[model samples]
Target: MADQDPPKKPSSGLRPIERLNSEERLSRLTPATATATHHEYCSKFARDFLDAHFYYCSSKFVVARGGKVKALDEAFREAESWFSKALDWIAATEKIEIPLFYESREVQVSHSFAGRLLRLLMQYDRIFAETLYSLNCGSITADSRETTTVIAAKRIKSIQQLCIPDTDKFAPDGTLLNSSRSQTHGHA
Candidate 1:
């Protein structure tokens, strides 16, 4: 009989374990953690409220000074209520800590991360409330627009400081900071 190559064995209907193994390997290699996407989204929403408030403040200042006091007052009042809603949302979100699933990491790191995020969110909320309160009392006079502007600037600065100190905690992927910086810097 002529020599012939041995027939290849058919694959065992079992989908190759390699795929499962690879997935398992990837999961293991990457830290097994649940992300705080909800918290982040809420924070971003709060920030947006602040942005809107600032825009309203500037426009109101200009319009009010231009003697359109009625329209400016209306816009300011609207901004104030919007800020209040944002503050409430942030407070509610901070009350809940969405746990991340990590593979046996030290509790301190996890706690620290949660703590920092909570603190930053709270700080932003407080600042928003304070700004609104000041605006409501007419603390920012039309003549002292510079002073009011300074106050607004300080509140924003404080928020930036809080956010920058622990970027990793609040924004592990740097997406938030990057987007904000790019937008602000581009305008500048």
Candidate 2:
């Protein structure tokens, strides 16, 4: 018979067995061997305290900074490999030219996809809360956040920053706050 092309291998979507298996043989654990895994005997709370705290702090800080909130940084880190495939993803850069509070002055805010999440926090950025602007504390970062982890022992040099006071925080009736001020919160 004339030479014919061999049948093509069926495309079974999987990695080669040898490539997936460990190159080196794994050694069995012996009495002397100490594995990195440890069984800590503590209350379930103490065991997960750090992780819980991290999630809380990360989410709170992210929202306060007007950034998109992720479900969990740990989960994000874990799934990054699997979810990084940009098969259906678009790498297009998008931006919205909206005036935001940078240094008490209205500056055009532009960033890579900042319009998606940053807009939540940026919406409230205004000196006067006459309209939808709820009036918010200025983005004030101190040179020495001594109370925080920034300061080792002594206070470092601080930045001389300023913010335009939110005038809408006051009641239009010209009286002390008698109603709820939950919606209109500012660090003035």
Please give, for residues 84-168, the per-residue lDDT of candidate 1 as tens digits: 5645543433222333222211111122223333334344545444444444456543444334334434444433333332223
Error of 1 at 171 (Å): 21
Candidate 1: give its CA RMSD in angstroms: 19.8
Tell me the whole-model lDDT of each prediction, alpha carbons only: 0.36, 0.23
Per-residue C-alpha lDDT of model 2 across residues 48-152, encoded as one tens digit per residue: 322222122222222221111222222233333222221112112122233433332121112211221122122112111111111122222222121221221
Per-model TM values vs. the true structure: 0.24, 0.13
How large is the C-alpha RMSD of every model relative to the true structure? 19.8, 26.9
Q: How high is the lDDT of residue 153 in model 1?
A: 41
lDDT of 1: 0.36
